[model samples]
Target: MNGVQLLLVIVGAIAVSGLAQRRGLQPALVITLVGFAVSFIPGLTRIELDTEIVLGIVLPPLLYSAALNFSFVSFARNFRPIVGLGVGLVVATALLVGVFAAWVVPALTLGTAFILGAIVAPPDAVTAVAIGRKLGLPKRVMSILTGESLVNDAAALTLFSITLAGVVGTHTLFANPVLLFLYSAIVGVAVGLLLAVVATVIRRLLKDSGLETVLGLVVPFAAYLLAEQIEASGVLAVVAAGFAIGSSSSRAGYQTRLQERQVWSSLDVLLEAFVFAYMGLQLRFVMEDLTAAGDSVWEIFGVGLLVLLVVLLIRPVWVFVSFGRHFLLDRVMRRRIASDTRVQERIRVENEQRIARGRRPRQFPVFLNWRESLVVSWTGMRGVVTLAAAAGIPLALADGTPFPGRAEIQAIAFIVAVGTLLVQGLTLPALIRSLHLSDPRQEEFDREQAEHALEVAQAASAGVYQRFLASPPEGVPPELLERMTQMVKRQSADAARDPDPDATSAYGEAFGTLYREVLQAQRNAVVDERDANRLDDDAAREFLEQLDYQEAAIVSRLGYRL
Candidate 1:
């Protein structure tokens, strides 16, 4: 296919995926399956495109957009677990699969097998977050999965690079892989931080919402390109920059929040659909490879199953063994020493309350819950990086003959990707239900927190009103305080209500009536000022813009139509 055909396919896939998402199916899965089916048509097999276009052009923006929306606070708080799953897990999976693939796949070299293992090691953030949101998992579980997916891509890419070098005999293990890994990681982080700081400073100076929003779009590309020029992982750079910006966003301004929400949400939807569609479109190449090696298909299938089993089983076993030692047995031993002390009694009561509330006791150093373990296991779906790495494999071997195991490797990678993404993702919700995992208490906690946050906002508004009453700002209207008072009271009431259908609907209707009146009054004031020439063209435009923002906020609060 030419450029135009590829573009059409992408756009069509996105449109279909959007409809599927609304109907409660995973857009990624739908798009991939459709793309795979389309590629089977006889004429469609000749489609050829630049692999770099997919990897370099498409990946950076998607990764950056995902990173920008990630929660830095939660990521930092859960750093240990995130690192364990992201960096450590990738390394472990690669080593295990590498050894097994070399032993099981008859003519494949250890280096080539290692490359295959590295290719499928990282999970896809787009698939993980999309499925997580659809399944309505708790914030903590989503946070863990999202964080792991973001960082693990870097780990997988780095491993792939090293293994690829080894495959061509350009590098050796004695060349110090550890040092190269550390160097790449450090450079990626430094580049990202430097670019993020520069972007922040520039945004502050301009302070124009449109300009700031455009700058946010460009920052990710800058991070990715600069890191790549320095021979570091662009994926790592984008993830680091995303964390930096998310952490700093609150101090930036309200406009930053509005702009980020608009920019990332649009980008997120488009990229999520496109990446999976690309994966599906490549299925024809994989299938062709399988058809030529029909007899070796069973060998490929066995290796794929072995890798999948290893990936799935290792996680739970590791968690159980680690948690048993650090949490359960250790806690019991500690409590035994404190048995005769008053502190022990206090601890016992605290543990009882924690148990009643479905919390792990404070004495445990590690999380021992089955729910957390299941989330970790279910989040192991690999996507774009795996496909890209597999596709990048050299087409020829040392004697210039075709690569011996190219088809087998591609087929195996495809199996793992589909198996994990479709089977595990689909079963995750049922697994959570069967495990009796409910996050109602977390929902209640969030509601209370929102109430407290709204109270603080109301108190600030009240304080502002009092100041305005004592000495209003010049040109401030007499009705400003009354309008502000009503707004504050409405917000407080909305916040206090349980986020349920009945309470939200009741408050929403009342707020809608008040909001329309307030909006109409503002519009009239703008018209009156313009007619009287009390406001210039520029001033009227600014006023309208501010009013538009306020109206959108009101609608969002009421959960009404935009």
Candidate 2:
């Protein structure tokens, strides 16, 4: 697509997202539906989905954003289930779907069917997590969803690479697929951690929030593409970098963290909008090709239905066999993990422990209920990543006879993605409601979180007070300093009461109202300096930017999450 068409797509998607926002629906669903409707408009430009754009450019930031916001502690604690679902379940789904497709379709080769299975295997838990956030799903369940989304890409891509190697003529990776998997996982993680350290150093040296944030925006894409160039898992690379950065992000300047969060949120919305919109637009394309295969409409529906059922069913079954059965057996065996040192570390959350000044005795329950398993199963909606992987399949093999059943595979993939999204995504909220999960001890949980934030904020500001006492700024009175410190303490107390506050969610409206006059004064002064020629144009703009940033900061409660 040309620049005009691309701009139109983005602008149109955003507009539809706005509608979705107003209607309390997922923006992705709305964007896709809008794109499907717009496809029939007279003289509209057709935009093809590019695997490179989706995988290399788009997937990284989405994964990074999800990774950054997820609780690394929670993820680590739940790594067993996360891995079981993200990696093991993905493989199982592919194998089952491949077998089912080859049996039912009759035309698709086993290799092509496996490729299709791989394409649709990664459950786009982005929608699930987003919905869970709104619905107040249990923290443990939310962690599993978020964690699965973060790491599943690597598994699906690994499988895709191996299967694609079979389709084409690359036997090197196939000779010892386990070694290829190890190489990809190990090298991808190493590359991600290395890049994260480099990014952190650059961020510190730059010391400019805007510059640092711009670099932060690029970190995930860089991690993915660079890792891929070195024959590693690009998906794992992004996840690793995201986890590294997220773990240490507490050390970053508040301004940089705030700016980065806002930037990523906006970027994520835009990317999802474009992805689903383009996905819907391609429905016509995939279906047109499928028509030439001369399969009856019922036959087509039967094949699509089988793939969808397998994708959806394999998850709940896997969750039970992999996790639920283990839960039951653990009671009989009374087992404990071998890593006692690591188990000691997981006692209390690392963050809460830091506030407590050391590790504290704490008990955490890891349990899986049938309700949660059902929720997880119903949330297996294939997304743009699935579409991209399928689209990425090469058109021709080494001998170049139009990779067997390419059209059929693409058709199946597109159908499965749209089908799951519509059938499962739309129905998931209702399923959650039907499950009737109890309202947990919300008040107690909220109290603990409030106490944690209060302690952390006090610890942080105490160091600043100590620095000020060491060397008081010239012209600043001790009385004024004391008053400012007291005011900050009061605000921190107020903020401790906030449950979750992002840039968009204003937890400090009272503070914003109090500071409005001062912000206006700063804006006026900056404009006056520019008008009087006391400040150059660039200097005036820079001053205005800082003023705007501070003004925006008024609404946010930094370092507040529960």
Candidate 3:
């Protein structure tokens, strides 16, 4: 597509997504279907992108935005399940799908079939996560799905490289696939951490919000390219960098934080819109190419439907087995702890010790209930990555002969992707509603913690105004000083009685430094609650965002950028 066409498609996709959202429909499904219908409108050119550009340009920012917002604490808490789905489930799904594909298509070799398997193995959970967020799915479920999306790409691409090598008659990148994966993961993490450190240092020194946001835009691409250059997993690199930067985000200026959030949020919507639109628009051309290659499009599509079924079926089985084992084990452990007095005493002592050390008591593993499992199982939808990987497949084999089933594989991949988006994505919200999944316990905990967090913030700011008044800054007018002292007294009294208190006074260029100090103190207190697990990360983040906005307004009104 030309530049004009691309712009038109993006605009149209965004408009469709907005309309779908307002009508309580899944935007991804609506956008993809709309694009497909538009493609058949007579003479539009094929919507295609270079595979390298898709992987390199389109992926990093989306991943980075997710990583930045995702709490490191939640990611670690759900680490096991994320790994199971992201790595273990992805590998299992690829093998099963490959087996089914080869059996159904006699002309395709096992190696080539595996290539198709790897390409479509990972479900792009972006749409699923977005739907869950809107529908009020449990926080833990959201974490697992979000974390899986981040890690699965790396796993799928690694398998893609391995299977692609086998089909192309080349030596594997490493003798042992396990070693290859480890090398990719380890080196990728290292590259991300290294770049994060450098980026953090530069961000601190820059001290300009606009410049910092510009740098934020650049970091994801740089991390991806640098890691890929060194044969590491670029996906991991971008994620790691995002996590590290996010952890230290509080140290950055408020304007920078606010601008970065808004910028990335818009970028995510724009990119996702473009991706689904491109997926739909290319379907016609993919079918045409298959026919030109002497492959029956209908036959290949039928096989792809079966592969899609395998992809859909394998996840629930794996999730149930893995998660069920944990659930049962947790039950057995709980019974034992309850039955044995000695064990109970030991646990009590350990809890006391942890409390003494200012740590939360050790939390037992809380596996998902069956309702949650069913919802998570049904959330498997595929999107742009699958199409991109299929497109990246080389057209010729090692001896320069045409790749046997290239067009057919691409067609199959597209079919599976669109099919899943339609079948699963469209129905996920209704499934979630039917299940009535709600976490009342977590809700109560969040309420209690939010109150405590508010108190902590008030306490932190309690002495700021007093300190300012006791030893007033030079050049203070007596009248203004008296006014400030009275405001400070009222704030103190309010903090003592009010559940939510405003501890900062009026803003002015002269008091800019004072406001900064007050804002910093409140932010630190809230972040401390977050670190201590007293406050939910999401709640803490929302509070932090308010503080950032307040500070940004102050800075803007002062006619200066910090």
Candidate 4:
């Protein structure tokens, strides 16, 4: 498709996806299936798009925005499992798949198979988080999935590079793979840290929300570009920079928090929509190769099955073995009994007298739950990175002939991606329900903590009001404090309300109507301003943009059509 046509397609896709999501369906799934259907049309079949443009240009922003919005405290607390799944699991899965592919596919070399393996290792953060959030999985589960998706790309890319080097005979696979890994990792980490530190310093000095937010955008690209220039994993650098910014900026203050949240939140939605839509657009290019031969199709299907089985089976086994070895069978049984015991009084007594006094209760991170494990397993749905890596594969062999299985590999990779995203993504909710896995009370506790925070904010505002009563600012109006006090109180009360109200019932309908009216009024005002010429071209555009954003936020939060 040409530029204009692509833009139109994207706009249309976003509109449809938004509508579908508003109707309580998965937006990614809708967009992908729609894109798949659209691509099948005769006129649209010949569209040529750049995969690098999608991955390099489009992906960095989405990844960075996701990392920025992720809860730093939750990520930190669950760092072990996140890292174990993110970095360690990517490496392990790649190695296992590489060995399998090499052994099974006769014409493919070990390096070539490793390249294929690495391509499919990292899952799409957008898809994983969207489904997880919709399924009402615990925040900890989302955290691990998000964290893993954020960083696994780096590991996959690193492995891809090493495999690439081997493919070109630039380096032997056995020759200093460790040094290559170390070099890329150290440089990426250093670049990310330097960029983050500089960005933090600038934020503190400027203290302007717009400027700080704008600077925050540059940090990710800066890290990515600098790391790439120095022959390192750009993805790793961006992820590290994101973690640094998120952790550091939280310590800055309320203004930083508010501004950063707004910036990332807005960026997140646009980038997410664009990335998934782009992933869907790839169907136009790969569909022909996918449908070529029945045998070829079976090979693709078999590879996808192997990948799905490996991803699902390996992680749980790894978790059980890892956790099991650390704790004895007797200890495991006792802990399980304690956790599952229906008699709260007896459990509490045992805990106080025997378990609490002398024996320390075994502690596991919140992300270690079976619910999280299932989500993590299902989340291994690959996207742009896999396609990009496969496309980047060199076309020629050592003897200057064309590479063997190039078309087959691309087709297989596409199948694996689509299968995981479409089937596994859709089925995950049912699987979670079937297992009777639910988030622990900790998530409810988090809501309460947020409520307390809002209360503190309201109390602080009231204290400011009292201080202003004692002595007001030189030019400030006295009525300002009263108005601010009322606003703060309303906000606090809203925050204190229960967040888990049944959405399909009367409670949801009540709040839904209230929010829908508020959004509609805001939208009408924007149109009125535009028509009345009160807001000029630029001003009206800005107002409309803000209005659209608020509308979407209200819809997402309330699950009500506007």
Candidate 5:
């Protein structure tokens, strides 16, 4: 498409996305349907890009942006489940779908079918994650879903590479399939870490917030390109870089943090909207390609639907069967513990000791209840990556022969991507609602966190005040100093308690300085809590934002730049 068409698509996407958000609907689902509808309008140009550009340029920043915001602590805590879904489930789905596709499509070889499998294997869970966040899914469930979406692309793409090489009759470096995957993953991670360190150091040395954020934009692309250049998984490289950079975000200037957050958020919306709309717009062209290739339209469409069904069915089946074993095993262990008094006493004593040391009592890892399992099982919505990978299929192999069933594969992939979005994306919110799922434990944990936050802030404020009393600023009259000190105490104590934005501050030059100091202390305390893992990353961020606002307000009133 030309520049004018691209501009129109973006404008239309944003407008529709705004409407969807206002109506409390999933913007992605709305955007896809609208794009599909718009595609039928006369004289509309079909938008297309080279598959490599789509994956290389578009995929990295989105994944990197997500990784930057994701909590490393949370990611590590839920590593097992994330790997299970991201890697294990993706491989299973690819193999299963590949076998099914080859069985049904007689013209396609096993290698090409596997390529199709890899294309559709990873579900873009952006929509699911967004809906879950809005509807208040538990933290762990959100983490698993988010982490799965982050990691699965690497797995699928790696498998795609291996299969693609096989189809093209090219020899890869690693003779062993397992060794190839391991090399891709390990090298990808190493590349990401090395780049993250370099980016962080450069940003720190730059010491300019705007420059830092601008550099932040380049980091993802650089990481992706660098990893791919070395035959590593660029997806993992981007993710690793994001995680590393995000964890060090606290060290950057607050202005940098604030600016980077808004930049990435806006980028995410733009890219996501355009991608879904692009998916919708291409349906007509995908069909045309298949028809032009002399394939039976109805037969391809039927295969698409069956493949979609397989994609949908395999997730819940895998989730339940894989996770259910652990659930059942835990039940047996719990029953055994109940029957043995000695074992029960030992566990109780250990937990009590842990609690006594100001730590949470030891508990088993998160085992999803039936409701959670159901919600997870149904969240498979294939999206941008699938379409990109499918369209990326080479037209000719190394020997200059037409790639087998390329058009058919793209058609089926488009079908599955659109089909899952319609099928699962539309229904997931309703399923979550119908189940009446609530994480009371998460709610209580948040509540306790809020209380702890207040306590920490209060302590920090008290310490600041004590320090001010101990050493008065030079050259202030005793009477004025006394008055300023009283004002500082009142404001510090009431700062967080007052939620009224309109409340006028009594802070002048002297009081403002003291209040800013108090805010800084409180921020430090919260950061410490976060570093120690005593606070949830989300909660820590929220508290830190409040402090930032307060500091900004004081600085603004003082006619100073933050």
Candidate 6:
């Protein structure tokens, strides 16, 4: 694809995304099927995607954007479950799938089968995470899903490397797989930390918001490349850098935060849409290769379907065993250790409402109830990571005959990825509806935010009023100054009372509506001035930026991020 084709794809994807958003559908799902349909149009050939470019150039920023939006606090809070699914479950699934594949296909060696397993093991939840969050999936569930997606790629990719080495005669370095994994993890993390520190320092020195965001873009790719150069896991490096930089976010200004957020969020949407569509865009090639493999289409699909079922079931099976066991054990031990004591007292108090409702007290499994486990299991949708790994598989073995069943393996991997997206992706709303998970603390959370907003508003207003009363600015009328102070007090107090996203708080929306009207009035006046030649175009633009900034601040603080 040249410049024009690439541009057309992006525009097409964006158009599809906009339409999907309007109809309450995931762009990845819609665009993918459409792209596949378009691929079959008369005389058009699909562009063969280079695995190196996809993995190296395209992946890091997407991963970095995901990491930036993820919360370190939430990740640490649900550390065990995320790690269990991301690393333990991934490794287990790879092993089981590899063994199963080798059993089903006698001609396929264990090593080659393992490569396929690793390729599809780690689930990508970019689409699910977005849709789930929008559908009001609980914060904890979203956090776990996001956290799992961020790290599982590193685990699967690492295993992919080890297994690939065995297949290609580079197995010497991976003789002890444990040491290789350790080296990859440690070095990746170290390099990530190094880049994060340097990036943060550079961000501090640069006052321009645009320049800061530009540096932010470089951090992820830099970390990934530097880590990969040293034979470490580039995925982990980008993740680590995101976490570290995100942790020090206080060092950034509001402008930088807003700018960075917009840029990364847009990139995430675009990349996810582009790559998923690319999956379908390459379907013709996959089908052609499978037809040439001397097997009926149905026969190949049978194998692919088997692999798909394994990928789908493996997650829930693993989750139930590991997540369930640890949950039960932790609750039992905690109950015994703190029986009738401080922690127990807190637990009882926390569950008092449930008790009042004639329900049994909740337990440690609250983080991932059985219902959540089912949903998470179902949401293990594969995206770019699986496809990239599959594409990276070598074309020929050491003897140069052709890697055994390369097309077959790639065909299966892509099928499972697309299949999972179709089955689980399409059914997610139904699953979430069935689960009916609710955030019991949502009201309390909103109340806390409202109270904090009030306190901050009060403190700032008092400080400003007191300071200005003692020493006023020159050329400022006393009446105007008094009016301005009074207005601030009124608006801030009203905003506190009406903090957004709480349905019960009508005042927030009311104030927001009025505030918007005011901004629009200012905008109208500025346009009038510009129309009358009282304001130059450049000056009008400057004024417009300020208005936009103010409007963004009000909306962001007074409403949900969406």
Among these predictions, the greatest TM-score belongs to 3
How does model 4 score by TM-score?
0.70
TM-score of each: 0.77, 0.80, 0.90, 0.70, 0.90, 0.78
C-alpha-based local distance difference test score of model 3: 0.80
Q: Scored by CA lDDT, what does every candidate get?
A: 0.68, 0.72, 0.80, 0.63, 0.83, 0.74
lDDT for predicted candidate 4 compared with the true structure: 0.63
Clashing pairs in 1: 1-47
Number of clashing residue pairs in every model? 1, 0, 0, 1, 0, 0
User: Which lDDT tens digits does candidate 3 get at residues 277-355?
Assistant: 8877877777888778777878888888888888888888988898679888998999998899998888899999999
User: What is candidate 1's lDDT per residue for 1-562, written digit by digit as tens?
Assistant: 5778778777977797878878988776778788888888776654544545655666677777767766565567568778887898889888888888888876568887888789888888666666556666666667777788888887887788777665665434347778777877888888998889989899889877788888988888888889877777676888788878765664454456677777788876776676667667777777677777663566677778887777667666655565555566666767775676777788889989977875546654445366667666666777777876776666664457777677777777877877777777778667766765557686676555444433433444454445445764344356654554466455434423332223254344543444444444544555344434333323443444454565455655554522
| Model 6 lDDT on a 0 to 1 scale | 0.74
Query: What lDDT is obtained when candidate 1 is compared to the true structure?
Result: 0.68
> On residues 1-562, what C-alpha lDDT tens digit does candidate 2 reach at each position?
7888889888998899999889988777677777878887877656765556767887788888877766566677788889888988888888889989988887788887888888888999888887877787776787788788877877897788777877787544326767877888888899999999999889889988899898898999999999888777788888889988876664566577667778888998888888877777766655666676665546776788778877877877887776567777666443453446565456446647654754333444556777887788788988868876776767678787767777677777877887888889999888988887545785576555444433443454565555545665555456555654455445444423332224343323323333333444444544443444333333444444444555445545442311
- Per-residue lDDT, model 1, residue 110, is 88
Error of 2 at 12 (Å): 2.3
lDDT of 5 by residue, 82-118 (tens): 9999999999999999999999987688989999999
Candidate 3 local lDDT, residue 35: 81
Candidate 1: Cα lDDT at 252: 53
* Segments of candidate 6 deviating more than 4 angstroms: 169-174, 334-366, 394-401, 453-562
Error of 2 at 24 (Å): 3.0
User: Could you say which candidate leads in lDDT?
Assistant: 5
Instruction: Tell me the alpha-carbon RMSD of every candidate.
Output: 10.4, 10.5, 3.7, 12.2, 3.4, 10.9
Candidate 4, 356-404: lDDT as tens digits? 4444343333335444555566667676567656655665755687666
Better of 2 and 6 by lDDT: 6
